[model samples]
Target: MKQTIIITDCPEQQGWQKNRELCMDVTTYLRSDSRMKAGKSYQGVLRRDVTCDEMHYNEQMVFIETSNQKRMKRNPRIFEGEHITITRRDDGSYHPNFRPIHLGPDFNVDHYATEVANELLWGLEGLVDNA
Candidate 1:
């Protein structure tokens, strides 16, 4: 079966740019430090679309295949949409808290989309590191 994936930020909220900028800022910070061990490879994209069975906010999902493997496995959920944001920290891990923005009285599409993107990126990070 085909899977549909959506990765976007609401145009009304300026948070989209903020998220991208935060990624770039974090990349820079990680690269500049002397004591930290660089991962040697990193890639990120804005509004990147991905297909997978598992989905979560602020965490990455991955799919692996082998000749003898019979079934696919999924990981646990990480963060929620209402708890995502980018904050600089002394620690090496990248922990961005993504908060949902209300479109009106009850809509929060931007926040939802941002979390998906964050999760996808996190998944990509794991895949690349393993590769």
Candidate 2:
């Protein structure tokens, strides 16, 4: 099954920075997966770019270079390789929610992904509070 995890940072101070860090953590998770590897390292355009018309003004786009482009283009649902977005709330408080996108019947994947995502958020709470 395919799944997408969207981790939003709270609206507190330095929320954008924290959100970026959490996104990095997600990337770390993807990197550790045996089925996946970091795609080509390309300089991503900011949301201000013309191609980013679909994204909100606050959204930052990061391109993921993947191995199996054909599979991704075909199935699209598999979380095996995808570029994810880490969104920040307009209120400036990090959104503590971790949204699961295109989840499948595998309870283990849902459970484990949510578990790790929440743990990452919890770890950020202390850091965000301190900052």
Per-residue accuracy of model 1 over 12-118 as CA lDDT, tens digit each: 35343332323321212222334434574322222333445556435232222213334532322333334443333444344555465556777577866776687
Q: In candidate 1, where is summed lDDT lowest over 10 consecutive residues?
A: 21-30
Residues 1-131, candidate 2, lDDT per residue (tens digit)?
45544455554543444434332212211232443445833322223222335554333344333443334232222111122223345544543334465656764776677766666655566546867
Q: Estimate each model's TM-score.
A: 0.22, 0.22
Residue 35 in model 2: lDDT: 39
Task: Let me know the TM-score candidate 1 reaches against the reference structure.
Answer: 0.22
Residue 18's C-alpha lDDT in candidate 2?
A: 44
lDDT of 1 at 113: 78
In the predicted model 1, the residue pairs found to clash are 60-122, 60-123, 83-98, 84-97, 84-98, 85-96, 85-97, 85-98
Residue 54, candidate 2: Cα error in Å is 49
Cα error of candidate 2 at position 112, Å: 3.5
The clash numbers for all candidates, in the given order, read 8, 11
